[model samples]
Target: MSHDAAMSVQHPQDIDQGHVVARYVSNERRYLKLLGGGFLRLGEAERAAFIAALRADALQVSPEEIGALLGYEWRSRLTAAWLVGVARRIEWRERVGELLLASELTYAGQGYCFALAQFGGKNDAEILVSYLDRYLPHLECRYDQGLALGALLRLDSRLGTSHAERFAVRDGLWERWVDALPHTRGTADAWADASRSRIDAWCNLWDA
Candidate 1:
């Protein structure tokens, strides 16, 4: 059966209940065409439907399709990154890291790297840190370097003293965190206030 036909066979109720495998398959196939064809006028209901479909099984996105998306323009890459953010599969996380590290598409690569850092574990952290140590100086944007720094921080938080001292000495990252603090809005008002206090405490400890 045709892709759209198959997707049509899936009950909308099934989609609402979180059965989105078929929908994702159909969407992936149509992504390029949808964009190129200028079908950007999806109504609220359709848009909501699409987002629900995406969230239902983002982790199931195949490596090949992910690779294909990495090759898309920056906007599409951002969409792919959002999908990765919702993904729960470790294998997909590994594949995302591999693609980001190897890709020449810098925009997508940066987004993928961020997603990997957000979702990845010790090995992903180690690989990313090693890559940053070697390549960060060559990166043009301070923002991009900051993202790598954030990833390192997340990793360090999990690894503790095993890697914290190493990160503490990374002047570029430490400086950037200091620079970024005033600009961060935090996760929410209460959480932001608490985080600010915690950060202040950490700063005080560093001074000591």
Candidate 2:
């Protein structure tokens, strides 16, 4: 699929099961379908919204059950990875990050690295950085370093707009970011401090 085609997918907001927490406890069939494929095979946006809605209101349920969705099946596996990577729950982060890191699937690794950068601390960031260095591709459509950098900036604002100033996305940022920019690096650092100059130099190319 073209980047535009891949990104056109929207969240199935119409499928809201009213009070996401209550319905899960009631064992609603639609909830399972929402995660699986009821309306029309949950797309990235739909899955992301499902996770966000659940995280926002479904705080009472067992995270393990919610966690199970990640590996329930390969068809929706990316959705599960999205849940693991973006969930605010610490347990989710730890479990998913570790699992994704070891996964033979590199696509999942991108999301895993992003989550680490968002919620991880020093060690987490280091792990994320090392993983990116070892696995992230240098060619276009495969480089997702922007997420790593964005996560670090989210973690530490001191890095400043200097980091995003040159980002090639002049119009905006959205789902297609993974395929929009061509970023490749010879090395990476979890702590912006260790590779301060290099990061700045690399980010400088955002405008180039």
User: Which whole-number lDDT from 0 to 100 does residue 96 have in model 1?
Assistant: 62
What is candidate 2's local distance difference test score? Answer: 0.41
Taken over the whole model, the C-alpha lDDT of each candidate is: 0.46, 0.41
Candidate 2: give the clashing pairs.
Answer: 166-206, 166-207
The ten-residue window of minimal lDDT in model 1 covers: 1-10
**lDDT score, residue 33, model 1?**
22
Q: How does candidate 1 fare on TM-score?
A: 0.49
Model 2 per-residue lDDT tens digits across residues 1-208: 1222121222223233223233342233333543312323568786556545644443444455455444433223344443444444456666655544444443444445444543546655555444344433433444334445455454344423333322223322222333344341222223223333433332232223
Best by lDDT: 1
> lDDT tens string, model 1, 1-208?
1111111122333334232323443455534323321223567676556556655546566655554544444445544664665463455666566544544343444555546555647876776666555444443333334455455555566566244345335354334344445564232234324433432332222122
Error of 2 at 79 (Å): 3.5
Please give the lDDT score at residue 178 for candidate 1: 40
Clashing pairs in 1: none
